[model samples]
Target: MWGREVHSHRVLITIRTKFMARDVHINSYLIVATCGGKAKREVSLEELRDHIHQYYIPLGRQFMVLFPEGGFLHKRREISQRFAEKNNLPKLEYVSLPRAGAMKVIMEEVGPHRDQAGTSKSDDRKDNNFNQNNVKILDTKSGDNIEWILDVTIAYPERVPLHLADVVCGFRPACTTHIHYRLYPSAEVPSDPEAMTTWLYDRFIEKDKMLEEFYRTGQFPPKGNTPLVTRPVRQDNVRYFILHLFFIASTFIQYKLWCAMWSCIW
Candidate 1:
């Protein structure tokens, strides 16, 4: 399995997992769903950690999806702005400040061993032990560990975000949904909670700028201030690539069928 720490939805995650992950010659993967926020029962760190150990590591799931923003943009914007104001942090209008507790747990459990790695000595936040009375279960090995953190910023056509209901009910017409990706080595990520919080804040701030540009110009700017080195997209064997199109189609069909069955059962 290619370890990925990303923020993504299920159907797309399924496709990416099929493309990047396999176990014992099988192209299959599992998803673990966890919630954030207080309205829907504030999830305890211990419970969240247990879920990862209980489902993800044991089942050998490839992707651990996280919505570090904790809630939808509209729902959390005011709260985030207030917190930012109180903390003297930059007021981010486009992206919400990320909650770092869950991120911290996942990284420590599966990224690098605490014994091997120490908390970052950065001045962003005082060096602190956030995870206290920690009892870890995941066997952290070179073969089994998170290697990449994919920061995926999804931009819908016309800056309108779509919901699962829209996709399920066929209310919205098909349109191009642009996704910009910035991948970070998991090793490069700060291990400690405070440093990780600062890291997430920095990422969201960058996202805010990207999003503002996207909304204004109708296209995401090339990553950072650097010039884009343009190259033609590689086209694989036409016959082989045609087969992949069929495969992707089959996945969407399967997903629709599953949704239909689930709706019936419920």
Candidate 2:
């Protein structure tokens, strides 16, 4: 679970147009885009890039999360497959084709490149010169590049809730949600558009396989081998104990008030 209190990083989520109305007030950092609608307006890559460079980057934000598959719908998956086939892209099983337009633009805009000081040596080596120049120029003041891609895969062993209401109303019982995190260095991500597209798909392919293994065994591959690491229980034990006492006292007071009301009514 992503708790804002634990991790202080600001979040920006991509949500469908239809679901946008449900919690309109909670749209401080959400990117709303229509899905399969006639008058759908896609989020512009230029706008997103500008926003990051101007706002997020200057503020020194470390992470930006993007769901390239858009939405996890079966129909969308079918459409993505058709598009991939037409473009001669690899067929993916668990994930849909990533919309490379924004990703490509973002990478070109923010991906790592040699700074002016580092580029000076490239003139000595003819072969290295071409490769150095190929890297896109960025106007970052700190000269730091987006170096890591944290690929997070979340899995619900039980059936996923159909709606947010199901979760709020506690319709679904306690289910095991497994999360696996992997960090890919900048060198691993290709800068070329076509290669980057394939790279994104390949990451998802691994996720698909991991999910398959999870469903089959109800445990991730590393579960048995790796020891579970968790936050110290003592950190919150005192807070929980105080809350438990408050709950008991409140219930007793409420019960007494209810009995007094019944007697008066009688």
Candidate 3:
């Protein structure tokens, strides 16, 4: 319901925990991709399509969070640098190169459904796939097509990012984080694979520069600091309590229902 970007605290949880049910209940869907290979890209695209058809179409979710870096910036930076060097591309320091195939899958499934009509735009490309998935998503009550791609840049103080464990365990003290936002219309994003890759790289390059400036000046855009990073850190105790209470109540209700049915059988 909230459209305009607001300064809000975030929750970070790792998937390795025994919280699979709660994780899947949310709209988050994970795609397993290889660090290097030709087949991994195709596999990731397939997984993305399946996830979109399952949850995105039914739930009518528009906003998508994609980490083009493939992994954490710290972990993948060296690999990205090596790949860039080998390919004679720009060597990024602050951010890793994002995957273009993922963008391709998203735009293809959530594109102009009526206009494309599965019609092939180019000989190299196959079907546009603008029929079933888009039709189902459009039919949902809360459903709407994707309109904007938000290029969010999150900068950690001193380039020190808090991990899932760090956030959950309070390993680090509360520190102000700076975030920058940019948006582009979906139409502005390239649909062709080659163009799309270039476009994504350009965005990340810009992001890298922003991060560099943020590290130097404690703010993005190389301008004076904004109140966006000056807000007081709010506590998440109330939210955690409510979430836990809901989980317990739901489990108890399910248990009672199961008991009632079993009593009749016995």
What would the per-residue lDDT of candidate 3 be over residues 175-226, giving only the tens digit for each residue? Answer: 8766677657666766666887888888888888877777888766733554
Number of the top-ranking candidate, with lDDT as the measure = 1
Ranked candidates, highest TM-score first: 3, 1, 2
Would you estimate the TM-scores of all the predictions?
Answer: 0.64, 0.59, 0.67
lDDT of 2 by residue, 1-266 (tens): 11122224332222111112210121223232223332232345545545554555444455555655555545466787888799886565555665555455446555653232242212334234322545422333333455666676665644252457755555866554556666676556776667888887777667767667767887555545676443322236588679879998999999999999999999
**Candidate 1 — worst ten consecutive residues by lDDT sum?**
14-23
State how far residue 221 of model 2 sits from its true place (Å).
Answer: 3.6
Off by over 4 Å in 2: 1-43, 87-90, 114-143, 159-162, 222-266
RMSD of 1: 10.5
| Stretches of model 3 off by over 4 angstroms after superposition | 1-37, 113-143, 222-233, 241-266
CA RMSD per model (angstroms): 10.5, 12.6, 8.0
